[model samples]
Target: MNSGAKDRPSTSFSGVIRQNFATKISLCLLMALTIVVGANYGWRRGLLVVVGGLLGVALYYSSFGFTSAWRLLVFERRGAGVQAQLVMLAIAVTLFFPLLAVGEVFGQSLQGFVNPVSVTVALGAFLFGIGMQLAGGCASGTLFSVGGGDSRTLLTLFSFITGATVVTFHLPWWKTLPNLGAISLVDQFGWIVALALSLCVFTALFVLVGKFSTRETRSLVDDGPVDWLRSPWPLLWGAVALALLNATVLVLSGRPWGITGAFSKWGGHALHAVGIDLSSYPYWAEYDFGRSLLGDVPTTTSLGIILGAVASAGLLGKFNPTLRISKRGAITAIVGGLMMGYGGRLAFGCNIGALFGGIASGSLHGWLWLVCGFVGSIFGVFLRKQLGDGPYRNTQPQVEAAKP
Candidate 1:
């Protein structure tokens, strides 16, 4: 190990201090931003915004789908790999929009609101999901993955932009079906009922998936065969804890949970720096499910995700060094970025926008995105195999193995 690492060693006081500083500052900033967002949108809406984000993250994690993507791609988990994903899909199907009806405290702002739904919106959301999975990361996942120095995400991120653009520009041509729909599950149902129903469904699926799931080589962070987190004592509390935190964010944040808007913004700004015009892209025709309601440029949520990712990575000792894009990958990143930007516009959202934000708000569009995205993921998995996972990989064992 490097002398600096040896001296601080993460467990050491100095290391802990360093690790916490980033998050502390981030949390403070995030909360402040949340307050501002809440004030602008109303405290109830702001709170719901944060809670929605928290719920999305926790539910997604507890369901154990997104984490598997890490193992399959980063850690090389394959074959039965789809097992975790399948469970997540079930969870996504079950709780995503249903929770909207009951409400999540602060979500009162969204209590009566509903996203207009249509077949076109559904198709767009679905396509976006698949595109994100293939791209190897959704908007939120891409932020986290890229923060950890994964170069492959750059490819998918770019592809997402390209796909979005392609879809957006052609939106007028495909305006064949109802796209936006009304809120079915909004806040009228009450939080208790929503939480209870959500928990009930999540529990049933968890048991089924856990019962049926195999445990050959499991990591503690994700559920798998022989998983410790899955054990009775830890499982219930773990779920509750994560769920509570998610609910809290909703009470504070105002909007729904999301991670792609700002990320896509990075790609957008990059185009501008090089004299490329983002305005050339259609603003109305694109997939941005939620317009810039938060604020002008560098919205708090997107910024939070990027910084949160950075903070998370640094604390975990995963931050190494890399420009993260080069050669064919560089070309891919730019193209993919455009696609995602355009796609986000066309589809009305990216992974978080459509999947988490839309679903949480009781939008049918979110659910549609999930279905189509799953189909797209299969194709994405194939692409990852062929093109190679961007430019990053686990170096610990793989590095030693590479030794001749």
Candidate 2:
């Protein structure tokens, strides 16, 4: 009987039990938090939190990363990630154009994150590109990666917050710099024309990248059987999910999805807690900073993203947290985080808020951001090489489907 018991594969059973238990706990926590947020805030805010969680799950399962996408494109001439981004942007603009043209939905007035195409945007986005390469993640990347148990990103987040806070003192001066002001393609050309123009650009980029990239084009669908609950999702799945989620956020919140503003808010509150007076700052005074510090959509959604990522990781049986940063890696993380935080604020947003939200909404600044940020990323890749980091390293070979 003991010999038979030894052959029963109890270890596999225990592993299943553990995975199930972790999944259950994650779900329960998510449900409880949702209820709490609903009870304290409103149902709308609570729903946004749930959306944030799903964003995390989508981000985690797909391992979708803007940072790696840019680096791979620059270093290895691989464009799979870039292609996925194009798909996401195309989907986003399609959904956004008609809705924005209407101006109002469900009694809520809609607004795009259109900002000035200024020197500030160029400088900020350029710096942000370099930060992306150094930090190994962008704003959304850092948050989701932290939620996925990457301990190094934790340090990056802290430094990011610090950098964002420190930059607020100088933002007023940056604003004084030359700017072309806001340019909305939607407003200028009407939604129909804007949509067609945006789609043409996306198609052109898709074709051009496909032609030049060294990697062979691969199917977005996973070849292996995918367990929706536990297995990794295909890149296209992540792209579609993100685009839809952003649309949902716009419908619910009356504005496009944003991430970095919450970081600024958090940093502001932290400084206030330490006896610093922020009311004097023009940037802080322009809004209901006190009310925002209490709670807001961006804050709740950001929290939800982290929780959702944790749940996603737990469900996947990959929630092993480790603080294994080498000295060089640690330096880069801090420096990168600081640059990202500062650059994000200066540029009016990070990848999600500025590039994704801006472009989808037909803001010209979004296009400017793309050009400047990509240029900056080139220099960043060079810097990474100088620092002795493997800028061309490919962590996920299957995703790239590289040519021999």
Quick one: best lDDT, which candidate?
2
Quote the positional error of residue 201 for candidate 1 in Å: 4.8
lDDT of 1 by residue, 204-321 (tens): 6446645554443432334445332222112233344333443334444434444455445544544455776445456433434334446522245444444555455444543343
The reply for model 1, stretches above 4 Å from the true place, is 1-67, 70-108, 111-113, 151-170, 178-180, 183-204, 219-246, 261-298, 324-345, 388-404
Q: Rate the local accuracy (lDDT) of all candidates.
A: 0.47, 0.82
Question: How do the predictions measure up, each by TM-score?
Answer: 0.60, 0.90
- In model 1, the number of clashes is 67
Compose the digit string of candidate 2's lDDT tens values, residues 239-301.
999999999999888899998888888898888878887888888876554564425777777
Backbone clash total for model 2 is 0
lDDT (Cα, 0-100) at 350 in candidate 2: 87
